[model samples]
Target: MNKILVLAAHRYPDKSRISKAAIEAFTGLADVTVHQLTHAYPDFQIDVEHEQNLLRNHDTVILLFPFWWYSSPAILKEWQDQVLTYGFAYGSDGKVLHGKKMMVMTSTGGSAQAYTPEGYNQYAVDALLLPFHAMANKTGMLWQPPALVQGMNDATDALIDNGVNYWLERLQELRGM
Candidate 1:
């Protein structure tokens, strides 16, 4: 069975309702490993060897984060800077992640409608996340379609339930990969 690693990054995990639930639910999956970035590197000091080892062991890597200020949390960027190093991830001999699958699963405070040209955010979520796709490509990992949970700032019970279901579907797809 292929192991899946979820690098979950949230600045305030407890305050994020649906994210907390999603993290808990995904953590229960047999082949999945959910690593909370903020919890791991509270001091912003990442253990590069350890993080790279996690990537080496997992076949699929899922970047589970909140869309904070149109970007990922600080730790996630720190992770990329530290863990995805020259000799490990992208040098002449660096191909540890080659052929692996990478996915983006992010939540937004605004609704889906807000991420359109006609909407306030003025761009599609997919458009905003092209950088992730490019990152996956640069690292020689297959980029999977991103799953977005929107309007979590005012989530109803129904929205939360749907978010759970959406995550379940993504997990199922991960197993197949």
Candidate 2:
């Protein structure tokens, strides 16, 4: 089975409902590590070498976060900026992530309808995630379709649990675990 690294980034852990539920669903699952970015670097200061080492150890990487302003939390962006250095995560000499699988696992406060072309956001989740796909391509990693939980702010406990189960099932299916 492929080892999975879940890089979770939440702005405020105390106020997190979806992120907490998602993490709980994956707890104790074999070959899975839930690394919380906010907890790891509270001050937004990232350790590039350490982050890269974690990447090198995982077979599949899942970026889990709540969509904020149509993008990831600032800390995740900072982590990306610092850790994904040239000649390391990209460039001719950057082959550490090559052939590995990667995907986004996210939740959005807005309803699914709001993310459509004709909706409020005027773009689908996949469209909003094009940059991630591009990053995966640049690094020679296999890009998997994202797993998302929509309308999270309005989601009930049962709905959140269902979303958690859905994500867990999808990940297991991907790894045949």
Candidate 3:
């Protein structure tokens, strides 16, 4: 079974709706660890060594966050900047993340239709997330297709429940990969 590590990054986890539900669903799963970045590092002081250790220990790394400005929240970016170092993630001797699988699971306020060329955002969610794909490639990790829950701003309880269920199902499926 693949040990999965979910880096759940939300700026305000207390006020969160979708992200909270997703995290709750991820809890208590075997071979899965859901690390809430905001809760762990409210001051944004990341422990690089510990983060790297977590990466090294897990077979699959899932980046869980709410989409902001067509990208991840500030803390997620900061975590990447601090933790994914040159000599650790990508360099001559930096292959700790090699062969690991990466998947982005994000919730967006915008609707699915709004994330297209003919829509308001004018770019597909996958296109906007190319940097993550490239980063996975650079680190030698297999990039899995992103799991997105869109139309979040007006989502109902039922919709959120369905999305959370789907997210849990995907995470459960990763153990077999």
Candidate 4:
């Protein structure tokens, strides 16, 4: 079974609907660890070595966050900057993350229709996620299709439940259950 690590980042977790539901759904699952960044590092002082160790221990890595300004929250970016070092996440001798699988789960305030060339965002979500795909490629990790929960700002209970179910199912699949 793949040991999965979920790096959950939310600028305001308390105010979140979709992210909170997803995190709750992941609670107490076998071979799955949900690490909430804001709660763990409120001061934003990421432990690079510890983070790297966590990455090394997990067979699959899931990045869960709320889309902000068409990108992830600052802490996730900071975690990437600090933990994914040249000699660790990438470099001649950096093969620790090789063969691992990566999945990105995100929530967006806008509806699905808003993320298109003719919509308000004027770009597809997949296009906006290229950087993450590139990161996975450069780190030798297999990039899985991303899971997204759109229309977060007005998502109903049923929608939230559906998204949470999808995330839980994905995690279970990753664990080979």
Candidate 5:
């Protein structure tokens, strides 16, 4: 089975209703490490080497975050900026992440309708996440399609649980590949 690393980032852990519970749901799962970026780097000081080491150890990487303004929270961006350096995540000597799999799992507070040409956001969530696909491509990681849940701000507990299960199932499928 392929080991999976979940890099979860959220702005408010205490007030979280979706992302935090999703993080908890993955607890105790074998071969899966759900690393919370907010809890790990409270001051936003990411340990680059340690983060890189974690990436090196995992075969599948899942970036889990609450969709904030159609993008990831600030800390996740910071983690990428710090950990994905030259000669490590890319470039001639950077082949550490090559052939590994990666994908995004995010909960958009808005409804699916909000992410459309006729909606306020004016684009699908996938369109907004093109940068991540590019980053995965640049790093030579296999870019799996993202898993997104929308209208989650008012989601029921059962709905949240179902969403979590769906992601877990998807990850399990990836592990076999």
Candidate 6:
């Protein structure tokens, strides 16, 4: 069985209703490990070796978090800076994540329609997530389309539940679980 790591990096966690719902649906199911970044590093101190080790063991890496300023939280960026080193995650000898799969599971406060060509945000979800896709490509990992839930700011419990279920089903399909 392929091991999956869900790297959850939510800064303002008290406001994360949608992201938590998605996590609750997947935790403790099959070969999965959920790592909460903020809780682990409240002081912004990350154990690079340990984080890299987690990636080394997992076959698929799912970055789960709310979209902050069209990207990931600070801790996630720190993780990428520290763990994805020159000789470990992306050098000539850095083949640790070569065959693994990488994808993002994110929630947004903006409506889905806003992330369109002529919309307010004026960009597709994929366009905003190009950095991640590029990172995956750089590291030789398979870059999967992101699982996005737009408009969580005004979402109801029923909406959150439905979105969570949809995301879970998509994850299972991605991992062939």
Cα TM-score per model: 0.97, 0.96, 0.98, 0.97, 0.96, 0.96
Writing each residue's lDDT as its tens digit, candidate 6 over 26-86 gives 8888888989889889998999888998998899999998887889999999988988988
**Candidate 3, which segments miss by more than 4 Å at Cα?**
none
Write down the TM-score for model 6: 0.96
Off by over 4 Å in 5: none
Q: Alpha-carbon error at 93 in model 1, in Å?
A: 1.1
C-alpha lDDT of all candidate models, in order: 0.90, 0.89, 0.92, 0.90, 0.90, 0.87
Q: Which candidate gets the maximum TM-score versus the true structure? A: 3
Candidate 1: misplaced stretches above 4 Å?
none
For candidate 3, lDDT tens digit of each residue in 1-177?
A: 899999999989978888889988888888899999999999999999899999999999999999999899889999999999998999998899999999999999999999999999999999999999999999999999999999999999998998898888788778888
Kindly list the per-residue Cα lDDT of model 5 for residues 37-70, writing each as its tens digit.
9999999999998999999999999999989987
Between 2 and 4, whose lDDT is larger?
4
- lDDT string for model 2 (1-177, tens) is 899989989899657887888888776899999899999999988988889999999999999999999899998889889998889889989999999999899999999999998889999999999988999999889999999889987989898888898899888976773
Pairs clashing within candidate 2: none
For candidate 5, list the clashing residue pairs, or say none.
none
The parts of candidate 6 lying over 4 Å away from their true place are: none
The pairs that clash in candidate 3 are none
Compared to the true structure, candidate 5 yields what TM-score?
A: 0.96
Candidate 2 has a TM-score of: 0.96
Mark the regions of model 4 whose C-alpha exceeds 4 Å error after superposition. none
Query: Number of clashing pairs, model 5?
Result: 0
Model 5: lDDT of residue 135: 96
